[model samples]
Target: MPPDPHADELRSPPEPFSSRRPTWDDVGRVADLLAAAERTRTGVVATRAEDVRVRWLMLDGLEDVVLVEEPGPEPVLVGVGEYSTELDLLDEATVVHVEGQVHPAATGRGIATHLLDLAETRARSAAAEEGAETAIVRTTVIDGDDRARAWFSTRGFVPVRHLLTMRLSLDEPPRPPTWPEGITTRRFRPGRDEVRAWTAHSAAFADVPTHFPLTLEEWVEDRILRDPAFDPSLTQLACDPDGEVVGLAFCRAGVEGAPEEGWVRDLGVVPAWRGRGLGMALLLDALGTFRTRGLTGAALDVDDVTIGPAVRLYERAGLRIVRRIDVVERLTSTG
Candidate 1:
């Protein structure tokens, strides 16, 4: 099988290494690798697939060694890559980001540690070119993936925020709320314009400390080009009398796994849109959609300390945290 079209195309001058871009042929094998390594503790199927695609970059470069299991009667897990990565500045600041995968079979080896170090050096160099002061590398470990989290902490990252995987059983009818006076909610049918909706989303979320301002092209690419990100019928939007998209709830499903589960990649009712019960209404609508699709449950991840008391709301709705994970940042040399 050929590599996936979405995999990065490597164009470096000839070197001793050989890299093969991961194709669709690699997806099933990669999926097996993830299961065997127990690398991912809990995640939406779509999100996991995205990670698989991102990791293909190291393979295409070939310079990064791959320890994949020999494809035969019984495949085994091996590690991938040793690529050094560095800074990619956003606007004027140097940024540190890492996207790589592990061979589930090779869990105890310090492969991830080595990759992170190489990437950190690249990040520092990238920051230097941009005249930025600091950079931070990031990764996630499932609550069950204790060893991985310890590995990250040993290298300097700390637990900053805890994310909870919450689920709402969709077997029953959702009791949606009635919006407050002058505020109304509706579904965002496919093919309609979402520019203003995006604008509202941007304005409402402008205060989030470290979010990137995505261009319209990027938004389109994210929601449209991404196959698993489709299914607009599952989206609900809240609007005011002036027709502003102040609140939004979007749900997507996993193709590789359970079809009976609808995952909420995001559900936010802008601050201005809050207090009117729009959040609950949007959530109810999403749950209804999931139920309509015959899904047994609806899932979403929320920050334990979000701007609003989201955890409380989920608890009230009969949803409980199924998994817990943390994201930490090492404050750069702040003067």
Candidate 2:
């Protein structure tokens, strides 16, 4: 047989990368890697180092998180992944959330696959440890990313929910929020209003299918109190005549990628206050607050399946759908 010219090329292996459990010291670089990936994929940078720190704090430890890097004098992070599990006590199911991202330059090099494998392994172990009767693993991808959709589909995940990222520009004057009669608004008081706000949120979202009320401690620890970007002055609470919280607007000064824009982290009205247009008032109040802060825009994400009222209220307040994320899940175990 004649010598083949491409045999050497076929024999050569792909470039090598290293993966290890992430540590607190890696938080900033992980955030940078994630931000870079987001920018390459969506032209937006929303992963701040603080956000990454909060996420790591939520985990039991950093062992479940993996970071992939190109080995060199100054190693570059090319991929990252993590998995966490929550036991749905009411539903008797364990929900595992697997998240991962790879640098655009490293796509198709099997980095994502390796990360996903690690995430799933951690997920399964966590679910088993919780002794859940059923295990479901979930992940999310941008709505229009067909490659990502196909990747999850082949891995047995099916699209289950759609979340809309809505944005309202503050270039023009925003419509002033009109409070319902006898209802007044005030800024959140860090020490005094934390429990009250949590109670209000839990009541407001009680009917939401995907929402499981977090305990006051869990709620406070998640993002509101711990996030360095949380500005109490920017967070508004609508109270009835008796000084009870009826509605709330939780706003963050800025998100990781878009500091010029304010983030409406949460807006909700209790069921008793729902029909009085308090939801719209809270939303507008958030927008107004953002505008007053000199932010160029305001943004928030809503679950389309569960929060129809929120979507309509946001649209009425001039926020348009800027992006969509699809949540996909796989039922890994029936028992």
Candidate 3:
């Protein structure tokens, strides 16, 4: 058989690294870039392929939101950035969330700046279309990453919130959960529990900082149903004797990179149920679920700056502060 003439073109080196819109084909390359960046900082590839894929699919503008840098023949991705304008779902304000990762080796080349510029332009344009009263661009930085924090600070981003990422080792069995009087727990009922769980979560975070109520549709689409990692068996809900959902511990199991870790994506107790141990019981139940699934540990995040006791509650439940993250925002509009 003769070698195909097009075979060389297929194996040919790629063009010089440049920024361009991403496609489904870029998911793997983008995941690699994110994983490499994660390993440099945390010694782990926390950003899994599923995370990238699901996030890309969930964002408001799939095509305009993503940018990647392909460097060399092998087409190794060195940078990723996404601009999202879905904050209108949280409020009428035009707020865009800008998130991205840059390869550690690719720093100081103006890549980050260029990405931010592109994101801001996209965000502002989206905001204008929405006729928003105000436009804001937001991003987060790990508290310990001085370089990242400085980079954003130099670009006029102001820190607005401090989030604590907590972790608990399951090597030691968690204390027996003591449910409050008249409260009972069970795994979520797939179709029936969606709205109920959403209600419980919204009520739980209502008093927290920057509280934005998510509509039932938004709640189901973004946080619950769309995630491939969501596990109803691991999601514990506390209900009253009459069957009212008073608390919840929504778990996300089988995260791509951290297979042995279960994420307590949302753990909360309704206002009336606070201080009755409902939250603690719900959290312990989630941990037990993880343990039953043979996970090594569990993790969750809280806005410690705003909800001090929420952090205390997790600490008392045996979770320690593994890291800190800063939420920063910049106004894209002059007025």
Off by over 4 Å in 2: 1-17, 21-62, 69-78, 85-92, 103-109, 189-199, 214-231, 241-244, 333-335
Q: What's model 2's lDDT at 36?
A: 82
* Candidate topping lDDT: 2
**lDDT leaderboard ranking:** 2, 3, 1
In model 2, the worst 10-residue window by lDDT is 4-13
TM-score of 1: 0.68
The window of 10 residues in a row where model 3 has the poorest summed lDDT is 5-14
For each candidate in turn, the TM-score is 0.68, 0.74, 0.76
Could you tell which candidate, 2 or 3, scores higher by TM-score?
3
lDDT of each: 0.61, 0.79, 0.76
**lDDT per residue (tens digit) for residues 142-199 in model 2:** 8556788898899888988898998878999788888899998889888999988988
Over 4 Å off, model 1? 1-33, 37-65, 68-76, 81-112, 121-135, 189-192, 213-228, 253-259, 304-308, 328-335
Please give, for residues 153-241, the per-residue lDDT of candidate 1 as tens digits: 87678876778888777767788666667777666665574686577667755666555677777776666566555777776777888
Q: How would you encode candidate 3's per-residue C-alpha lDDT over 222-280 as one tens digit per residue?
A: 77667787778888888988888989887887554467888887877889989888888
Q: Would you list the clashing residue pairs of candidate 3?
A: 14-73
On TM-score, the candidate that comes out on top is 3
